[model samples]
Target: MGIQRRRSWRFILLFFPLLVFLPLLFSVSELHRNSKELDQDLGSKRSNKFDHIVLGPAAGEGLSNRLQCSGLEALNKTHLSHISHAFNCSEIISFVTVFAVYNSSQSDEKLSDLVTVGNNSYSKAARSMAILNTYINFIQVSMPKSNVIVLSDPASELLIRRNNVSLLHIQGDYSRGMLMLQRIKSYIAFLETRYEEHLQGKHHLNHYIFTDSDMAVVDGLCDMFHKYPDFHLALTFRNNKDQPLNSGFIAVRGTPDGLQKAKIFLQEVLEAYSSKYMKASRMLGDQLALYWVIKSHPSFDVKRFSRPEAFMNEIHGAQVLFLPCAIYNWTPPEGAGQFHGMPLDVKVVHFKGSRKRLMLESWNFFSSSGSDISDMLCLILKSGRTKYDF
Candidate 1:
């Protein structure tokens, strides 16, 4: 009996450690398995989030092929701004302006030669500053309740701020190429950031109008919304070919479909920049990329406007409504003097090409004459408020 009792005690002691260690070992193994599964789930979610954000084409395939194969519906929704159910076009429309200026050794010389400011020699950056300030002030006067955002380099942020414009500083080396590529990238970046803000419920705009620094608004654009209520996107054209659209002025609706199209367009532009075909074809710059996007994607509801007297001219293609160019994107006739008369209905002036010199001259004339700057420069002078000079 004693020997049997001793054997039983030994068995209990030996088996007790096994009973405890086995359950602990099983628990640890189960925990490890669960942790691995959780990690995999998170990884998959992350991958799915970024699945549609293809900045360029994938390996071993051309961009055209990749675009054809990938269904836009399968694109990740989180990367885009959720269309607000409460969007009201009347109350929310934003004007987006972007400028990129690099300070180089020849920048001053470039500015002085680009636009001569009477006897005063202003640096290229200085002229840019003056132009932007005038543009902002004009917008404020014409569209007092409108939202304005300016995206620019850090050096120009203060200048933009002084004009009571919302400034977003761009960070990068912008000293490369003709800067047109960088401008397009900046536009995309701003759109992405705005999308993020909308997702966070911080932004509520349903429409956006993007313009360049050298343009000024002289009249209200409220009628444009009423006229083009159903249009998704609108772009100005420089000619009838509808080949290369001017990206300087663009209007976009913030609908889901519109945002999706914009994303696809920007992605295609990136692809073109990196593709060898672009190099061979000499299809360089943002304008060519835009032309390609419009050509490639025929289903995007885009309108092109071009009428000599319209606010924005050089429009082509079908379904395009003409706005008076004399008002919206007014550029003086070649060889015309700065004091040349313009139509009374002129709403905006675009100082493109060699016409930039006229902008400074007109601004000076109006400011000195005590004439209402809101009126077209030529109209004010024609009213006999001041004599035309220069």
Candidate 2:
């Protein structure tokens, strides 16, 4: 009887371990199955979300059909396909200029008053036309081989005429305050369209440079492209102490990562504008949205130019290269003895603030032959304004 009891105890000890382990083994199997199912579900949901955001709900549609329906295939074939990538600055970069012109009936009294040039009271649309014309003329003289694309309303198309330049009429209400955020959206759309064109074997563009209509190119930007080969995006610093970066002048490279960053920037701006909390905190505009984007993205290869005397002052991600403001984005300061003529080194002039009134004056001065540029530079250097000038 004692021997029989010993055998039974041994059996109990062995079975006891099995009993404890069986439940745990089954539980672990169940958890693994559930985890796999959960991952699949989440992945599907994420895919759907991405589709809705990028393709406008009809994500199943074929690429060719969408391109054909959107009339982008023709554009791609015409503008993108034939271009070659030879590492030449002109071949790699295209200058994109945007303008929103309003007629007398659409513009307010303030805009109307601002439009008047000298003795003639021109419409706001006419003034914008003049500004764009001057810019185009300057670009032609300075960078004849450079590619230019102008985005404007249909009405303003009549004013711009250049054989080498491409004109795209973007239909939208670009009134001063209404749909202000849409400007950035439009820019993203244009960039994406170009990207698609590149993917379709139509064109090969490495970079896009964006500027406002009031801005004019005084020199070729080939050196800048050669200088920053790795940077994905370049931004000019705003003159305002509160706003450090200006979206007015942006140079973005054509890469998957760069495009994705731009999309994120635009999305964040849209979300911030829509958010009630953020809307109340600050003035909701493209500049503010850009500020948020730059601050949010610390990893991006963003180059900021932030010298007080430089045209672009502060970049968010990288060190400042200190490009001369007298050449890049020369915004003339206010005060007596301020030089109004274009300096030799000035590449582009961005007319901002009350100094925007000087756009017409500068445009006329630069277009004419009689202005003494040397004397103007002397006056600007003598006046204390050039120290902190934008």
Q: What is the C-alpha RMSD of each candidate to the true structure, in Å?
A: 25.0, 24.0
* Candidate 1 residue lDDT tens string, 1-390: 999999999999999999989999999999999999999999876444210112222111222211121221212111011112112224456678876665647655663344345455556556667777667766666666667887766654355445446878876435545356556667678767666777778866567778877776766666676767655456655433544355567666676545445555566675665452334232246666666655565554334323242332221222323343444555553212123334444456676654444556556555565644432343322222221111
Runs of candidate 2 exceeding 4 Å displacement: 1-92, 106-121, 153-159, 238-240, 255-260, 274-284, 297-327, 334-345, 370-390
| Candidate 2, 1-390: lDDT as tens digits | 999999999999989989999999999999999999999999876444110101111111233311111211121112111112222345456778776765556444554244444444555446556767766765665566666787766655355467778888776656555445556656767877766776687766566778776676655676776666555566665334446555567777667655555555556666655552234332346667666655565453333423334322223333323344445666555311124333344456666543333455444543463433232222222222222111
> What global local distance difference test value does model 2 have?
0.53
Q: What is the lDDT of residue 135 in candidate 2?
A: 67
Model 1 TM-score relative to the real fold = 0.58
Against the correct fold, how does model 2 do in TM-score?
A: 0.58
Off by over 4 Å in 1: 1-90, 104-121, 154-159, 176-178, 242-244, 255-257, 273-284, 297-327, 333-345, 373-375, 379-390
Candidate whose lDDT is highest: 1
